[model samples]
Target: MERAGIDGFVYQGPVRVSPIGTHALYEGQARFIQLQFLSFALEDAPNLAGWRQKGMLDGEYGEAFDAFLEITGAVPSEIDDPAVALFMLILDIAINPSRGFPIQIESFENFLIDVDAGIRFVRLCQAARDEKQVLSLITEYSFTQYAEAADILTSSCGYDHPLAVIEHIVEWQEHSPVAKLMEEKRGFTYDLSNIVVRVMSSHFLAFCDDKLSRPEFFCWPGAWMTGARASQDITNLFLKHLSLFTDKADDDGIFPRAIPGVSEENAVKTLTAFYANVINYDLVRQWILSDGPFNYEFGWLTSKHSKEDMTNSTKQAFQHAFGASPDSFTYTWAEVK
Candidate 1:
């Protein structure tokens, strides 16, 4: 009869908590409930124990189930008994580190029913389209809520992971009405190069100087390039857009206009350093200084430049423009690629 902590419930007798009630529980409590239910189900349901003995609940699947719970906050108590039982089976075939679990027809119908219920609950609780509300939704486990959070971040905050989330949503809900609507509205084709370009352009215009707080602009391109399902279109688009910043050079040397909270010199240097790190020095030099268009038709540039070369180039660029690197200027990019 443990207290449910933030959910303000105590397990009484042999009665199980409803999925709706489980949803109200805090993460740790929810995890406890899931484990408790799983253990009970395993003892009562011989099929589950048989499946577990058959390597269906191996360490890998167990770890993935843990992660799934972490991300989606799903509790066994929240899903139908049949669905929960089926999920253990699906976990054996699903749950890869890189590619994620593919939707298996055997369990997905019940999974979707649970997902829809979570979505309705989240939507009902949503107060507004502000950052707080959006973040809360994103932190939820339901597919629709995750997608909606990504969309809100993209449209309102100019955050860039929405594309990845949308891709996942499309895969999971390929035949759903919502998925169809998203495909029609967002053109959820595998080709995301054009969308990346447009979104990056808008993000640069909107939040270039605010990169300290929202470094997603810098990291996102690399993320897309690394994870892009298509070809080199993403890489090409990134180089092309980065070239635009190079084109912003003035007598002051690459002074991006209208960026706030920093001098033009610092902004240029930070951005240049970021580009050097992501694209390599040879490509940066070619795209920034060369008069020709970047030949992204090919993959990474053939010209070999060491990390030292890129670092020195960045320092030289800063020194030439600002006489010295700014002592306190600090900007970082996520290691997405």
Candidate 2:
């Protein structure tokens, strides 16, 4: 349900059934979903002021990576690689906050969902001569199958095995010949866009399929949500809206009749309006100013910013991994002399 993360990586959501029934005549959205894992994690430390005169390969930060793995354990295991672990530990700190456990997240910001197509489809339905025709108009554009995006993984990413991208990154960073190959391939070609995403998505899924199935975990897709969660609680909100617009085969609500009744005219009209407004949120710039905290689905997204206390944590991880501070990798504030 979330899009990009703090590292600026893209996230493709799990396909879910779109209410209004799978589009019968037209193509419907893909509704199947799989949880995903991204390649990096980062946190920032701004309070310590300084600049490094030289890289210290012998520093404590080098071992910090291992310490992290020892704690989280076995398989959110992508961190098993020293290079990835080090990179994640050293990168710029996270500006937005949220839980980062490979499969859990509760907050995010600046997401944008494009609704132009959805809006157009709604209008077409609204213009239908009658309820039945309205259905046809909407179907011409999309199947009732939950609204899959234009870039479904199977169609966009395909089954080809991905290159050993992580290894390649390590090689490139180490001044190996791989860097030249990547530059040449980039050749400023727009078509090469998202090539990394395809590679990582495939890699992540394969990892999850083979590894992350322990009974102790319940996983889902998306990244550190500053506040909003990835849970049935969220899903239920979606379903609530869906039920308002569409009907089910069985009558489960206590009433024999829909409270307002007749999904044909009024309900369909209301749906058209709802479809037009579901844009993604931008928590920072677009957040509505409120007086004090409110309690509800996304009410926790109130804005706040502060640097993390990564002091010993980062170096400790490096120490645990490499048995040293990884001196050259970490910088200290200009010594007070």
Candidate 3:
């Protein structure tokens, strides 16, 4: 496939591990599970089956499923087990799929099921949230204890909260000890890689639920970069990254290590260079930077420079902000675009 020019990080297989926990790794795993559950649950539903059959699950569906497997190494049976139902609840609320798979909860009975299971899962989510707020789990809490809670939440019937439950969870996380620790620690001690994994997982969930769009993936790369501004700087970094490559090149050929961070001049230079290498970058750039579905994926980040609409200039601007090079590497345009 690489030789054939079909490489662009396409989704692969199933979960290899269990999908429940308070650790950052678990957070990533849960998000993957939720994304897959959302995609498959909706795709498999009786009502939405027809629409899904038309190909809604064809493009990124595998990505979500593969994401689940990558994060949580559970087999297909484990993923589908009734004991793992809480995974469904979190996906339904946080990664609610409306288009390919819509939520049809109209009765108290279904709501009860969700509420019962979600409560526990939400608690685990709360614990994890607190740890994130504090910016350190290994340093502060017992990983075993946190994992135990996560297991209970992931496998039991406590994940039944509506969207409102998320608010409470957030509130709890905010007031929790972990939050204080994170605030106090600030930039002194932070595991950015873990943070990136968590954010990517969350964003991936949002994308699966149709809340987030394709372009938002760019911000994730930036979030993974070093520096405080990486957190605040959101200039549609993904587009610039994508545009940097020519459609005629290999996947790994894109994204050079020497690429600088996003900046004004660098952004324009990168955009011009991408256009020079791959004309299709223009089209993909538009789809990514457009003003559609970003908030659905990026929840809180949209408020700051985080939440933003698409723009024709976004490709250049993003590259400028990141200081990327256009000729760094190459990949076929159709693979990722």
C-alpha displacement of 11 in model 2, angstroms? 30
TM-score of each: 0.21, 0.15, 0.20
Q: How many pairs of residues in model 2 come into backbone collision?
A: 46
Q: Report the C-alpha lDDT of model 2 over 1-337, residue by residue, as the tens digit.
A: 2343333233554432212221311221110011112211223311111111122112333233222234333122222232222212111011111123221233333221111222222222222212222121211111221112111211221211112222222333245443433332222111222333432333333333322221011111222211233446544433322223332345321111232224444433333322222211121112244332221232121112111223333334435544765344333344567
Candidate 1: residue pairs that collide:
19-78, 72-141
Best candidate, TM-score: 1
The reply for model 1, stretches above 4 Å from the true place, is 1-61, 64-274, 277-303, 320-323, 326-337
Residue by residue across 1-337, what tens digits does model 1's lDDT show? 1343322233443432223322332332233334433444443533434545656445434443344344444444332232242222222111111122322234322333223323322322231223444323322123354345445433442222433432443344346643443342222121222333433433443232232222232222222233222237544444433432433222323333333344555544444444434343344565456554332321221234554564456556545544754333344445767
Worst 10 residues of 1 by lDDT: 89-98
lDDT of 1: 0.35
Decoy 1 TM-score against native: 0.21
Give each model's whole-structure lDDT. Answer: 0.35, 0.25, 0.33
Higher-lDDT candidate among 1 and 2? Answer: 1
lDDT of 3 at 185: 25
Residue 208 lDDT, candidate 3, scale 0-100: 35
Candidate 3 per-residue lDDT over residues 1-337, each given as its tens digit:
2243332312452212323322423343344344333434453533223334555434344333333334344233332332223233233333321221233455433342233322333443443333332212112122242333333433333343233233333344355554643442222232332342333333333333321222222212221232332333334443333322232233322332223443444434443343333333443454467533212232221222332332323434436544643333243344545
